[model samples]
Target chain A: MNTILSRFQIEYKPFRLDIELEFPNEGVTVIFGRSGSGKTTLLRCLAGLERSSTGYLRFGDQVWQDESQNKFVPVHNRPIGMVFQDARLFPHLTVRSNLNYGYRRIPPEHRKITFEQVVELMGLRPLLDRRPQRLSGGEQQRVAIGRALLTNPQLLLMDEPLASLDAQRKQEILPFLIRLRQEMKLPIVYVTHSLNEVLQLVDYLVLLEKGRNVASGPANAVMSRLDWPGKDWPSTFGAILTTTVADHETEFGLTRVQYRDQSLYIPEQPLAVGSPLRVHLLAQDISIALGKPETPTSVLNTLPATVLEIGPTDTPGSSVDLKLDVGEPILATITRKSLAHLQLKPGMRVYANVKAVKMVHEIEEY
Target chain B: MDPSIFDWQPVWITLKLAATTVSVLLLIGTPVAWWLAHTGSRARVWVEAVVALPLVLPPTVLGFYLLIALGANGVIGGPFQSVTGSSLAFSFAGLVIASTLYSLPFVVQPLQGAFEASGKTYLEAAWSLRASKWDAFLSVASPMAVRGYLTAIVLGFAHTLGEFGVVLMVGGNIPGKTKVVSIAIYDHVEALEYSHAHWLSGGLLLLSFMVLLIVYAFNRRLPVHLS
Candidate 1:
């Protein structure tokens, strides 16, 4: 059974959040956007919190909103869970009680996930008895996630769940999120402005700009597009690669991933064989050569790729975003000076050298 | 000294008056304060100002108006007496109503502030979890703002315990029925019974301080960052 949440040109007055999109029945669909892109508003609309002037919202068999018919489902009746940017935990409730609050709301028969399982999944065993105020920020967010999960929601809406956390905290909580995706079997609409958030967890990307969805496709395909100037920079720009760990060398402290038969070694991760790892190769870190350059001083990760297209960097930087089709279309950033030195062009057969592969995260998926 | 001077009727009447006033205030104040906390109505400010009139206006003005409206042949008293066959003036019920009005701001303001402090996020979370609005209010919002409710109750009770001008104007200082502690203290001093005045005044002073201490002690344990 397909769970379809279709929006027929949603419009918010004074702000143009007009977009039509279909979300799949499974995994995480990241709503990637810059700030003020109406991603959160879209999630709110889908969750029946925001009533658009005209839109059609459906989930599987249930019709949530049909503006023409004046049919709108209230937020309380909708079977969806949302985790806000800050952990919106009930201050009066202990973590265990907060989670149980959701569980009790669902009918006894409708509850598919048990309380203990949620506690274990979110690593909330220690914090179960503590109130939200007593927990750390990261712990509070985890409790919030657990609270949402225990509801057994049909679709989970996360609006930048990791945005409030520091980098170290984000790293800490991401694995639990991956576990939720893999084990819960619930579709998620995750809204985030951070590329790292999208790269680590998302299988699909709905790119939004100025309240409009600019692009929508699978994670790698959409991220690798040369048109977006984000690809040329390393820190903020990159493509999310959906590849599995093929092998790992413990002695060299590198884990090999089969990205279209191109063995790439990243910092060793404790992932089992066939474990899917979403690695984000920063655009600036990748340099394209016309042919496989033999000058190597210990950059072990190099792959034969064909340049698909080149686009200008969105910033003042002279670097260009290049789409390379190896296993999947990956984006590489090269400076204009380097581009001229190598005489690179679209459709040119080139070997891309990744100085260091940063493994974003690895989580088993259903 | 006359033994009747030390008669405990005024003390008993004072406790009864304070208890009745606080109970009525809580019952009427909670929902109104909750509405004030959540309402986006333009008239909310007006209503809030009316509730707070007792705080800014002289107590005699409030008492004088209430006494006129509730007295025999007054606007409410004529019809109320015909229906109930009892004048509300110079009665325990009159004292309760007067105290509730006098202490309305003390109760409602703290509760409103507490409700406002607890953001709409918790309500949204509860609704998204399929809890109805009422259920969310009871389970999430009420518990979250419990500290404010406690503060309101304590302040309302203490403020009622200390009321003088309103009780005197509305209740008319009848020895047993209408006499609250503060009014009784006033009557004792007027009669040159300094010791009797001291007893009632000192007791009320101790009682109000104890109420404040208890409120602070209880609230100290609550999460300060409720939002």
Candidate 2:
């Protein structure tokens, strides 16, 4: 697949953002960082909401912005969609007209999605006649998403769309977001600070620190890197495993998932067998053993794994991270003493013991 | 009080002046208010102060300056008279020009308030949705500012209807062309025709009160911002 290349250099007083990256023009590419780390600014630069004096942005064959040639595309002219943190719906228009606001503006030939498709995709049928204030926070966001999607944009940029919702509201809207990722073909560049959101939706990851790109790669690879600054590392220091539901042990109240040849037992999930799921394994939740354990173990998940890399601990004498390949790269944080006791090294086989209670059930499918 | 005691010509002239002034104000005030609501330029403050000058200055003071500006020999009236053989002072057109200037702030301030309260968030959202700048203003900003329009129109019309000193100085009591209701009512009181003064004054008081009542009642139903 071709890549979208973006280069930007922006300076506003005390902050300067300089980044250059190439990412696949498919799936969700999450820009993850702390609050003041320039994630929103980068999204604005791409959307042409904020013009960076020195920037170059290109997707496929088109150049959206090129400062050297003095080329620029205004926000209305760009074939892109943006969902803000606030829903920002037109108050005077009903839900139906709000969705139609963009659909009617684009030329008929340029529209890729129909109004009916958007209404169905966002589940906005029931609220069509109502005003925006009549809907809840989650419902308003869904309409905002539908309104953006109806524009037939080549790319979708979301700036913390879930940030304004309460926990219950977040839960209400998350499935629709997952459906958007799974069902839509348009590439999405999502900006968020929540690790949970990144784990669920991110396919490619870019880690930004102090307005600069510190790391960028596959989601799992960047999440397991131990050398990242400690402040922003622990939140994302986890392994992401792509597994499929193999069996439902209704009698034992467990769902058996398969990653390659190994099986992992988790709390019984409502998903059907053969459904794809991505499981997040935090490094702190994983413990290592030299050999496979005997029966009668309290931990329900134990898989054979190989150590891929051993790196220094962030805190002195606290713990070191062992990058393990358990079908996929899984991170394990063990003390220096345990590291020496196990005589662990690259390519050495070990047992990765994960407590069933620590396994999070938050799963997203591609 | 005999019905024959009232002429009604001044009442007709006042309504015509108020209607024409309000129409012209809407045509010009909408853009000026929109600009005031959106502009960050330093000159906005100066323009705003000029628009609001009539609100604080005495009506006769404003009338005096307008008298000079609209006289046959003055800047505006001199050129107008040279092009057309009629002098602006003591003419119906002179009354409209004076009333529009006097009621400028009434039309602009409310609309400016409405536009400011609506903010740029919705317009930006419209722009992202592929609405051009003009389309966004018409479809989004204009409809959202309906309350402001109502307030501006009512206030500008009512203020023009009740104008006294400015009309007296500029229009100067020409019987049919420039003698408005306020000047006629003054003539009645000065001539000791108490019944004639009572009838016109009572009608104006009730009309002004009802106009304000309707505006306030309608404004209560529409919020400043949609959500």
Candidate 3:
């Protein structure tokens, strides 16, 4: 598979970024970080917008920048598209013309993404003739994404495209973003500070802090580590399980999803049976039970989970995290007192009551 | 009061000077303004000061320097005289140069302010979309700065139309060639032709106000900056 290899070192006075890595050119590789962690700066460097960065950068087979041989492709010459935090639409042009700004410049032989495809994907059909200022913030961002897609770039870089939008607007645009990721199968290097975005969109994850890479790997592996910058993990920590809709109990307003060989009930979802769904269950949300509760408890889903491992997390000294083999590896956190009281240990069989599960808005490719 | 006594040559010369000055300023000012707006170099402050020198300096001071610079033996005028065997001082070309220099700030500052205000995000967006530098400027920067261009043109034209000290110093009142509306009005006042001076002076006043009014009105209708 084609991959992007890069080694970059940049300095902004007191802070410096020194990193070297290679990632496959597939799926969304999210650079997750906090504010001022040099996330945007790193994305800018990938786009050739940060000239001060010195090192070698190879996108697939193309040498975008190689300082050793004095080779550099300017931002305009690179086969990449970028969507900034704010929708930087050309104010003077109507939506159609703004979308066509880059489209008109590309040679026909190089046009891989069609205008019709982008317009449909971004839901921009209705706002074609309108000016950018007339559109709502969400509509403006949609056009920005569409404009970038119409370029048919080899790589797409997004720098907090949804950062400026309110939560509702973010929800409105995320579905379209997921569609692009699915339908186009485009390689995207996305930068975002929101953990919600990570839960919703990330495939490969790179964690950053103070301009340095903390950890990076497949999203699940990195997340399972439960280490975050300035975040209380194992509490905010969760597992993303790729499951299929098993069935729906309409009378009880619940949907059953099959994870591994076990099925769990979540609040009713509008999804077809046997379709794929991503279930996000927080470590804190699952409680341990010595046996399957004979009574119909308020907790709906109970699974007989085997304790795979038990360990005290380094950050939070009071709680112990349990890795359970519930047909799938799921993490559960409980206080140290509870662990002793229940005598929870590896190789022990126990029932787990799943208190909450969130259905994130994107399908997962497992 | 006598319509026949009024020579329209000065009116034509004034219009010609304003149009020529505006065109020249636009051509040269755009790149300079763009550079000022985007460059991080230490030379920016110095270049800005030189461009805005006319705004602070008296017109006659600018004219006095241009007088020497465009004279027969001066640096620029010396080369031209050797080739064409003619002088630039007191000619229409001399007035054009003086007017352009005087209105340099008017043209450049507005465009630079607009370019700086809108910032680099949009331009970077265009470039990432594969637009060349010139392509991005023409399609994105220039169009977004429409108000800046409008203000620059009107201010440059009007400021040149009201030219007096610089033209008087560099361009001697040669009828049908160097004589302009301001110089014509000055001549009427000196000759005690109060009525002739009144018509010309009032015309310029009203004309400047109308042009400025139109610009302000149009600008008010436009968004201060496109979001």
Candidate 4:
């Protein structure tokens, strides 16, 4: 697979960052970390906003920075668009002119996206004549995104674009972001701390802590790993499955989703049959059983599975997580007593019962 | 004395001098102020102090130094005189040079403050949008610093218009050439021509007040986000 490689080392007075990683040149790559974890700093380095003395970055065939060669492309010369946390729209220019600011800079023959298309995609047509201050926070961010898109950049870097908004405003802007993700082919490197955002938007994940990358891979694969740092382990320890709506039972108020060869039942969703959906199954919500139950079980779904791995839980001495391969990796936490009772071991055939399933609804398109 | 009998030559010369000085200051001070606002070099403190020197020094002290610098025997004036076969001292060109130096801080300080307040955030945004450094400054920084430009123009022009010591020292009382309103008023008061002094002084007072009033009022109507 084609990928972008980055290697950076930064030493400021109180902070030092050293990371080297590669991510696919398509889909959303989330640089996920808590505040002060240097996620934003990493994005800045990629954008050429913060220069590191010892750094090398190459995106596909283009070389952005190579300190040893004394080659550093200035920020303006890079074909990358950036959306800052504050939306950083020019206050002196109207929203129309602000969008035009970047659009007019690129030569016309090289431009890929038109002004009208960007305005339509960002829902900024109504706000064209208004100045930035006159728009709401969500509106300003939409304009910021439109301005970036109109630049026809090969890559877009968004540094916590929703960090400054209130919860309601975030809700207001999330749909637009999802549309951008779905409609545009531009590769985006998004830095966010919101778990909801990660689950909904991230395809590739890079976990950063204390200026270092601890893990980086496909979002679902990295999230299912039990060895992630303790602080983020609980929040990120879940499995993500992409399923499609197979059928709906209106009388029973159930939506049957097809995952691999098995059918999983969820609460009735207002979606057309055959539409794709993402399901997040938390490890703590699953249970294991030695044999299939007779009938009339309260648990909504059950599947035959084989134990893939057994690892100690984040909270030691109490429970262990059984990574079961029910066609895909599904995690189930059980007590030491249950583990011994079932004689659970890797490669052991068993039945896995899911007590609950959460449909990640934000990513669904109407 | 009748108003018609008052010499209007000084008024015209003062206006001309102030306009020319302000134009030159804008051209030179803009880049200096921009550099001062964005630079982190060790020499920034020294440069800032030098720009502010004229603000604290007495006008007569600055006039004394300018007189030596522009005189035919001094470094700058010697080469200028030899090249042109004309003395720089006691000339309108000498006054322009002196006034530009005397009013340097008036232009630079406001611009520096504006540029600093405009901040790097917007410039970075512009850069990420493919704006070259010069393009970003012209389209984003300059427009946002409109208040600073206005303040600089008004202060520089008014301050040069009221000049006495610097002009007197460099351009010694040449009518229709270097005899500006301030120096002419001084000459009238020294000669006990009290009515002429009062008329020119009153006219200057009204002009300065009106210029400031217009700026303040127009500034209030500008969008607050620009500030």
Rate residue B133 of model 4 by lDDT. 91
DockQ of 3: 0.70
Chain B vs. true chain B: TM-score per candidate: 0.93, 0.96, 0.96, 0.97
For candidate 4, lDDT tens digit of each residue in A1-366? 478898999887588889998999999999988787889999999999999898998989888899999999999999998999999999888999999999899999978899988888888889999989999999999999999999999999999999898878887787788778888998999998765655667889898988899889888777777666636535336687778899999899999999888889988887689877677787877888888888778887777889988887456577887787876676777797888887888999888788877765343221
Measured against the native two-chain assembly using Cα atoms, what DockQ does each of the candidate structures obtain, in the order listed?
0.62, 0.69, 0.70, 0.79
Predicted candidate 2 versus true structure: per-residue lDDT over A59-100, tens digit per residue: 778888999999988899988899999999888889999999
Clashing residue pairs in candidate 2, if any? none
Output the better candidate (2/3) by DockQ: 3
lDDT string for model 3 (B2-89, tens) is 8898778898899999999999999999999999999999999999999999989988888888999999988777887898888899
In candidate 1, stretches whose alpha carbon ends up further than 4 angstroms from where it belongs are A1-16, A53-56, A229-238, A283-299, A302-322, A332-355, A361-366, B1-5, B222-227
C-alpha-based local distance difference test score of model 3: 0.85
lDDT of 1 by residue, A36-139 (tens): 77888888888877788788988888888988899999998888888988888887777888898888988899988989898899898888788787888899
Model 4: per-residue Cα lDDT at residue A130: 95
Candidate 3 scores an iRMS of: 1.7
Q: What tens digits encode model 2's per-residue C-alpha lDDT throughout B157-189? A: 999999999999999999988999898899999
TM-score of chain A of 4: 0.90
- Of the candidates numbered 3 and 4, which has the greater lDDT value? 4
